[model samples]
Target: MEKTYTRFEHYSGDRTYQNEQLVEQALANSDFDQAATQGKGFCRLLDKAYIFQDEKLSEYSIVIYTLDEPGLLDSAAKREYVLSEHDEMIIHRMAVVRNGQYLDKADDVQIRILDHEEQGGRGFLTNRKKLSLIIKDLHLQDILIFENTLVSHAPQAGLKRDFKHVYQEFPDPFWFYDRYVLRTVNQTSQVMTYKSCFFRDAQHQVIDPIAIDLPIGESYVFEADNFTTDYDPKLEVRPFIDFATKASYSKVSDAAYQIYEKVISQNSTWLETSAPDLLVELAQHETLDEKIRFVIEFVQNSIYYVYDAEIMDGHEPQEPQITYESKQGDCKAKTVLLKSLLDYLDIASTCVLVNYEADYFIPFYCPSPSNFNHVILKIAYQGRHYFVDATSRNQFGFLQYRSVPEFMYYLPIEPQADLQFREPFWHQNYLVEETVTCMVTEGVGQIDHTLLLRRQNADAIRQMFKNESETYLFNCYTTSLYYNMCLTDNFSEKELSEYFTDSKIAIVSDNQDLNELQIQHDVTLLKPYTVRIGKKEYLNYWDRTYLDDKARDFNSRDLPFWLSHAREKLTFELRTDRKINDKEKVTLQECKIDSDFLCYQTTKAVDKHGARMTIDYSVKTNAAIKGEELANYLSSDKKIRDNNFGMTIDLFEQGFFDKLKKSFVKK
Candidate 1:
């Protein structure tokens, strides 16, 4: 079991390996320990890849050698391969080797094929098949080696499939001993581009591949040995790495637009048909915004989203009529339907592809149709461009939805249009205004709260109110009261609904120009404003700043933080029956912090009977706070925190015995 030599070797042509000498050579040149622990087992040796290219076919072969421990028997015993018909890729060979001997026994291996549809999940229809294998008699310290080959058929005319962009990492971080060799041959007339870089030290250093022109075709080779190390915390927030190779296209967007064109051309016939009666009726609204909203809502709510990856043919979208008839489709289908609806209304709209995740790496990689995962509709109306995601059921205000991140890149699929990355306009006019009125009577308190939300905030709140169930809404309010406000008493579902219904105010008003939604509600607490300590009663008002938690310890973070541009105002009015002394009044003060990135203000007023406090806060920037700006941002945050954005009052009630004692002491 103590065989010391391990090596891996791959040849360019149809040559076959004779023995284990290649594996020994690879192990001798590297500092990899074969017996080291790597998760379940050690991948002690890797003769990774042997690729052969021609004008019509591209073939790839990979061989992996594993040293299994007691717990890692299954790791070397089972394997799975994914093959797709759409890519015209197939597995040509698979086998297992043990020690220095090939496992030629048929009883030692089992193979099974499963269609992706039978796997049961929601995703793009890949039309892929899985080949699974299980090997028996796998034991500890066993060198289990397996080899497989894949051949990709040449793509048909007008369909660009020769675009090869291969990204492989050598000396994999998870493998105790790993090696890689990638060789690519371009048999076609198209020029091939290849690039490679070491992970840590190769910043801004470009390494060009050495290309050799053979009698039949050209070949490009790349080899690397990667070592892992601790990275700077600031590097965590850096943009994605631009490392990839592409052939047959100059720009990444060019390849992407070609795929988009194919998909759009195949589905454009659906737009020529007439609109459905329901859509026709909905489109008869007086304003363009109304018609747009009606169509968006219908598509978002009426159709179900089901992604059948088994039947999906590459990036092509299904016909709009098919989606409408089936009442189910993925993002592409929904976007196609939405675009068709816009076509019927004579509105200019296009399908735009976007990556919704905040930390997407597609921008740095070689551009291909696979980069985008989500599709949204972009419309030009009233001299403005608006982006709409019809796949989402909860989005409101069409273009003013706040859930969509600002400054994300998007690709619009349109003919004669520049295929470049673009960003949506950053909206900053959203407002959230809250007013609370409190009254105390006989140790109990009644609180009335009113909120006016405008623009993006209004849309979000409206969608929440519309979609959430009554029980869910009640739970949300009760949870907030209990955790944030320290209100322990709970209300039943019926009682909570009744309280909401009684205190709810209508949205009607004379100011028809206003685009804000007004919500008013009232709640009664058993002992809302005071906590008794012996004979004295202390006021229990809590600080109400929404951003207090975010401001706490923000300076300690190494990465820049993102602050969405928004304006918020909160007002509170307090009234109590207890006798109030002049000195007992809450202090009246105004605090303000103004910077290029943020603006904040807080004002307080006190009267003989009650007091009122108002706070105005706004973020002026929508970017990350880094370097010197981080200090300024933290300064503003500290000012807001120190001013007591949610400061509570420290008022106590004096008893008759305490007043008499004070009077006697004064005499």
Candidate 2:
């Protein structure tokens, strides 16, 4: 089968074409038919790119060939293209090819333009437009090709005016492509370099253009065939793929620092006068830490986050005055405003750029503005450094927000700042202390539960209560008890409310206090603690056995998984009015398993009238578990789960003799 070739170019409103071949290429020549046979339904015939000049002009073209499947035609027929209409970039040409004929007239294709303002954040003020095109007469075995050439110029103003960075991400073959090509045309004065970071099993070959001694320009081509399975369900955590080519100035840090320096200096005058009244009021805090916290909270909670990309120069932040007046800004605007307030307080702070979702791969990429998705402010206070993300609404304390893994690879946008990786402070784990008491009488039990949470745990619970309705929260509590205690469905909302009352949630923000949040739930239910079998009643105490079920499935998994650092303590006290003897005391010897990955212990004690059990479970490691360590952890977890902490109490039933004795005692 001969390869069908179609090429088109448009520059300065002039359209040109070459090699318009109409060869009927066999479906078997590519992997499209095989993927269709396997129910994939459609495949990309060509996903190609061409970067002309530095970041100035680039052309991207895609050709998708759909199978004769019902559901797949709709997806393959319509196409959407997103582009930012900035003075620096222009979409010079957009054309579509159906089968072997090119759509030369405007009416040949159905084109619709829509504002691409994303929800949950402010829309970019720039020319961020979505172009939707519908191809006419699309059919199976017919090829559909769409191409657009974008010419990018240097920003007329701002930090990016001097430097140019170009980034192109090629679609992975996992989308069921038989062949893919990544071509880069570097027509700049600087020498261009290409790095291939494709998946291990991806069959690929790179062809570099002949090197010239002079800066005449060069082109690099990368081609790949077939798709390699890149995901594993067994693995709990995986590193994202860097399947893109970045062309920019050699020094990434230098380029970023230049932008940071320029933006900050330009807005320094406005920063001096643009402090919000709320921020000014918060500035009265006696301690620097308190002031910083107040500023962080103000920027995070007070300002509504909206990404106004037009007013705010892309990655560059708008003036602090504008952010204060708007009371709404994205991460960049919030970070800038927070930094400005900190500067007014004479605190040492720096704006840092980070990729919250893909921080693991940021260190490997060349430093460019496009590398980062989120921005945060770093403050140095009293012989320590605090990385504060003002965009986080629920983060209260200084160290609480830094617990996430993305902070590990954050880059400070400063002129000599080295790439530094941060380690999560293990001591800052959220603490959860739950005390539950159960009192039983006449086959019914009342539960009084109080939870004391600190730091992240407190923030999480508070957020839940604030967002969820009262009924939803009650249902959650009921669900937990139902699953843990194997409770019957005999308890009604009115009966449950008498014993297990509505949760009384209180949050304390005192900086010096030990407990930051408290939630209490008291409930009464029928046969909550006791299960009846025929005429015999058995009392089952709250057991930590349910925690073990999660680890059982991991015994067979060979891949490593993320284990969060945690410190949790649960205590249960059960008291019943049923008569008992001292000799019937049941005690399970305390079991403790301590390792690098996890630390767990449970202690149980039973007496004549009541029983007490306490479980202290903590995850000791912040890294993934694998190899022998994973096996050891799984074995220990199994041991912890296998040790039965449940004890049964037999209630004495009144006999005929007791009835006669009661008749004699009544006189």
Candidate 3:
């Protein structure tokens, strides 16, 4: 006699409706699966031992709506399912949304039972069947529906599927639908992708997949696979990819013409007086740095960054006025505003639309707006093109500072177009300085690290930090050996177990599993340096994950080499400090600890053995640092800020090698 609750309801024609109850008491009984199955069954439970055959319906109908693009709705079909009930009949319906279109056409709209059921008190119905469907033409606004079921005599025809089946039902919104435009340098090509997974029609299930070759100067490929009843299948195939309209590029469309006249081509009254006055005022700011800083700060902190390309409906290239008027724009709007501001200042700037999410160094070369998710301002300063995105606040420096390997940046060549493309190496010179220091106690440590980064692409830096904020929290370490140690306000043992790994013991909070922690890492060094040790084995594990694999790419064995060298020195430092037993004394120095950057100097000191060790590092990368160096530093820094896990960590030996071994030793 257990009570159960149903989140949703299904109904048939008669006054009968399907309900669910939790079998709390049934668990104590002999039959558990039977009770659970009765409450959560998908197929019908036929009484009197009757069997039914699957068959196709007489007719099929479908309706489609194109909400995003025109050719997005061409190839389309529909499907529906019907189920017979004792009192009345019920139809279970489902639809697939793909390529911004709906696949309504179904191939085999039939159902079969797998398990047999005995007519008893909520007897077991061991039958499992699947409904199959196929459709063509998919796009953004695409949605499929069981038209017949919705219009049926039953009260409910709305199709429903469980969370486990969500992927098959719809394409990942984050990975596909949620993505904005990502374009190249010339604005000639672009790429579209989403942030996460979503429900979409599986490829194998798609029947009669068709491609719409647009008059645009582009090619397309459409595909699908695995049509049978394999739920949650990893079946993947390309479907409905098209290039830009060459005809439209040669002769603008009515939409483009209307947009240009309505926004871009029109001369603004503000340009006559207010705009010129603002420009003059900006110039009078005393120095180029001041004016540039003002522009950078204005764009970064003020505008609320949001990608609205998908939501603009039929809107093509956005106008600067509209973006300025709206006070908000996606990547396009923000780019336009920055360009306009630069124009007002009489700065030589170009408006470029590129995919900032891919190929950070290379400019995207495409005419399609679909590939450009970000709009940037390109200014030629001293014979170099500097990329700047106004949608960021934490970003500091030129375009190279914000460039990611996968992001493609697009730039507008002419003064009239929204944005075009550019090259990746346009603005390649930049520098970053980081210093990390820590003081270690028996099982505790304190770290202080600072970043002094310099660059010309201010816009790029702003955006980098916006996404980097979350990543930054988890990128560093309280201790490299105890890299996973979490800092929280509470000391609950449950929270401690959830956040604390065996590598790091966090006692900053009181709720830790002190019993387990004390016992596991109880091995202590005699006195003065009487630090407890936790998992020394993890030191080898750390070296394996970082020093071995990661160092190979750089062709450098410095991490392991430094770790080994540092370990030897630590004994002397510990021994010397233990004998002296002085807490107030501090040591300092300037010396190179590695070969990567010779300018970097390491200053460190050990006081009272396990009580503390401090390090202050400084380095100046070569003036010509570009390409990988620029991209790596920017991306890594942004990643650090974006992760919110509460600690920063790096594989560099100098960054954490000493602290890691000590963390394990003191555990």
Candidate 4:
């Protein structure tokens, strides 16, 4: 829209964005019918551009929202954006368009900067901030413009010029149109090339960004005007485009390995200074597998996970000696330490890079360290390769049976390689088995819940046991049972504390080597049958939501539901110590629902005397669910939710209840 775009030339700080021409252009393109169709505040403009000037990549975005109704004024005061501590954000423009005149509010606006540590509890300590701007006195049909540019700084020391992997965000989830453009000027010695994935050309074929060769100072204006998005844009893997000088995936692998090799060589004391105390424990075990297990255990447990903005994280591991002395490192440092110990023990192992979120689409991404977000050690022993993540603390046992993230693709740090399809190596079992048993004695019911967890869930529970107090754990169990039994989301602290007065929890069994954990949660309720009378409903244990939310990610016609990520199954057993002689209520029927997303099968079994009722629900993970099959899948999901697993129990014999009170009183 402007010649030269000189404000973006040197990338300073806090420049007010002004482009009235571009704003008018985008507003003219905005459709009123689409805006009315959405029935919400319509977005007039969403112009995002990536201007790569050699080693630096600065993203300039200008989003303008038109408040169509007075109701949307509340949202106007809540305009805020997050900024990384290291990066610089430029508030280019802040203005409002009314009656074809711009009210310049940039100079007078008072924006509050807040400490936005939303996920600090999850152990991720990123120094990011949230800036909130207040727009006062907003009216109907007023177009508010917010323009800013974020100058992204490279993560760390080694890869300054290496433009490896970059994630591009998707269009805003509005019914309006947006623009995505990329402009660059290569002012370096390296040849500049770009690769993008997931975008389709006019022929409906997957567009390959590898073939795109941009000359010096070339401007790439990617047009996506008529595109419509129905699914959550956050979950969608938007066009993943990155610039890299490397020719192929093989070259990219070679470059990465060379960097690692050089770093290891520079810090060769890790190999020469003899094994540390943590690694020396491997000598106590005779077998190679035992020694490998010891090494893995030492790195996993000894070194706690600390997150840094490690891009494969910053693409370089800390010096092994530093990591060992500190006993804390990110995924890259931990894996490097584990690999070093394996080398000391004369074991053959290598570090692998993978992306848990992208799963299958990783193969389509350009070969760069940025495509991979996690690192794990892959041990080659006894004619097979077993992957183990150093960040995982609670996993135990031999290398083969040990659990790992189900990333569908992995790239090993070798001389040359491509993204290889990873097959299942870890043993698969029921991740969780929940047994809810209710027994009544003297008009009081004791509902005992035994949870048997394996693998990933086992690891999670072990963390809870280690970190949380017994009282906290007991309260958690009580809260869970209260929610499931009552089937309500509404919670009052006063009532919850008063309810479940005699709740107790105990760790029945915990075997770390086998990766199994079992806990019991029991609560005594007074006349629970009276409160939950006539066809008591129970949730299907794991799938408790009203509808399957994962099904919505594949809402688009092109993207498929990534099934490799959904590898765990839940087995729930519900029982009651009461007789159910009614043939209609206890017919012992087995129901099965097969859909493209998942297969759900449930069975009801009763004892010979009909004294106890046990209902079981089971589902096995399958392949990816394509979008075309989502309708049938959603129908099955709706069917399961609509019929909320009702179980009718005979609390009393016919006419026995009415005679009890009268007979006892008169005699």
How well is each residue in 385-448 modelled by candidate 3, as lDDT tens digits? Answer: 5666676555433333333222333435343444333322221222222233333344333333
The C-alpha TM-scores of every prediction are 0.75, 0.78, 0.39, 0.69
Best by the TM-score measure? 2
Best of the candidates, lDDT: 4
Better of 3 and 4 by TM-score: 4
User: Quick one: ranking by lDDT, best first?
Assistant: 4, 2, 1, 3
* Global lDDT scores for all candidate models: 0.55, 0.58, 0.32, 0.61
Better of 1 and 2 by lDDT: 2
What would you estimate as the lDDT of candidate 3?
0.32
TM-score of 3: 0.39
Q: For candidate 2, lDDT tens digit of each residue in 349-374?
A: 88887776666545545445566777
> What is the TM-score ranking, best to worst?
2, 1, 4, 3
Error of 4 at 364 (Å): 5.1
- Misplaced by over 4 Å in model 3 are 1-272, 275-284, 303-330, 356-367, 394-406, 409-432, 437-667
